[model samples]
Target: MIDPFGGIKGKELTNTSGFFVDKEEAIKEVNVSIGILENKNIKKPTFLETLRSKKSKNTEIHNNVWDYVPNTNNEYVNIHIFWSKKVVRSKNGVPIRALKVALVGLKAFYRQINTLKPDLQHPDILECYKLSLENYQNLPPIESFISSEKQDLLLDPFAGVTGVDIYKKYNDLKKDKDLTLEEVKYSINFIDQLELPKSKRDKKFITKKPKFVTFTFPTSESYLNVHLWWAGQIIQTRKNIEIGRTRLALASISKFIENIDVETPDLEIEEIKEMYEITKVKHEPGKLKTSRIELKPISKGGLSYWSTKTHRWITGKYDAKNKIFNPPKQNL
Candidate 1:
């Protein structure tokens, strides 16, 4: 059993010196402590009794308060100390004993760490302290930072155009800046009439119900007959692609209904409207395509490279008229 209260006899310490726990020598001190108690002249002491008997108040702590043990380096274990009274200055009002008891606990914990590395000179035991008054990091309107201590507070946010600028820009200002009683009642009616106007698209689509329809992919056509025949199909309102003939023959117009380049030689706005009939979402309202599931082992040739910062798969799409994505010529 280690005595947290290490070797110190109050009578033995000079004004400038107190006993320090020796990691390698702790066993010797432990034996000595046992010897002291068994002596007929000395009392058989409990841990606290030994601490009270050993404490010398004027003892100072200097050094190793922040050391962490590392595998390669020599590690130092700590020393534990116990004390009964705290030393005070010449004109002391409050006894320093209360502070001394706390420091004793702190040093005792450090003694354990100091034992591991005998070469360590300074033990990792920071001096313990208590501030006499609250140190305010931000200047509060209150006179003092002390809690439960009576304070006269006059609080207001700082001011200028920074103050009045808020009033002209926001209806919220009526509540924050000290508005007059009459102004407060009047602002309720004034702000009630203010409205954020509904935008053009909001008015257009907000109430309109979406139309959904499914489409079968068109059959492939022999070289020349494709576009000529496709135009005839939409216009004819009917076509027999197997025979490559239509009841009506109109040019095969491109049917694109997604975002436009705005720079692309786009079809007229009226034509864009007609495409809605074909591209209207199927299965789910506003959903253009049904879900697809894909999972593939990615590789440069045939092996995984875990070094990449990001890993994902890429997919492609097409644009017929510009031949832009029939085979994308450049990265998009």
Candidate 2:
């Protein structure tokens, strides 16, 4: 008889009294053992496959599994595995076993989607997934997809410092009434002199107008709001020439926020005043008076109102029920 477990040597058959009573019985026992081993070797259904098999039983849970899959350009299976490991270490509410199962499901889904025909694929969903992957491929470290607390640590150079101080400094600068255009210019130059990370250095700050770059921090929104106020001041006072300067200033400030540390000082604040004086002229009776204008039908097939103050024809609304044309009220 053959040795099913491969323990016997040199084709020697065991004696009848050794294990089995007869050669036929011994051969039958060996065959039974081989069949049992083969059954053990067969692969079991993976978690992903199991989920797919029961799709009709629980639709919501199956749909929710997709949330765990990272929408990145990197290999979906690899990224998801890393993410699941991290989530486990963090002790978040998500169960490690569930995450593992979701990962397996994502891998199966990825394979299915890639193998599907283009005509059968969902165009909008596929387009969105592709865009998300492309967008994150070159994402900066400061704008990482990790938790907000981790992102703050990555953004701040100083270990203990955060965005709170930066927010306060901005508020103080905004309150200063002595701020001047020269001081604003000086602050812009100071920010420009500061070094930025290599990845951010090549971005264009001064275009036809000012181009603003967004940063992430605890007080980032507050800082941006004040920054906009400053931009508005510059626009109203200096108009177009200083527009490029404002853009450069915004870019420099963004760099400063990204590289903030304990050594950095409060950004200088200067109040911007109107450059030109305004003179109000009183209107004479004759100057305010105009000739009577004729009301003409609108070529666009609508009722028209003649604006006596502006000396122009303006569009008016017709009241279908009242059979009246309602002209807009004129300001005195």
Residue 218 of candidate 1: its Cα lDDT? 36
| TM-score for each candidate, following the candidate numbering | 0.12, 0.15
Off by over 4 Å in 2: 1-61, 65-200, 208-332
lDDT of 1 at 261: 18
Best by lDDT: 2
lDDT of every predicted structure (CA atoms): 0.23, 0.28
Superposed model 1: Cα runs more than 4 Å off: 1-21, 24-94, 118-332
The RMSD (Cα, Å) of candidate 1 is 33.2
Q: Which ten residues in a row have the lowest lDDT in candidate 2?
A: 276-285
Q: Write the per-residue lDDT of candidate 2 for residues 1-332, one digit (tens) a residue.
A: 77797985565542212111222232332233233323333233557867777434322211212122133331122111111111101111233224344334333333333211211112221222333334343322221211211111111111121112221232222222113323444444333422344355434432222223222234432132114223223322222323223333443333333222212223242222221101001111112225111223333233443332332334445576997767544431
Q: Tell me the lDDT of model 2 at 157.
A: 11
Candidate 2 overall Cα lDDT vs. reference?
0.28
Could you report the Cα RMSD, in angstroms, for every candidate shown?
33.2, 25.6
Output the worst ten-in-a-row residue range by lDDT, candidate 1: 123-132
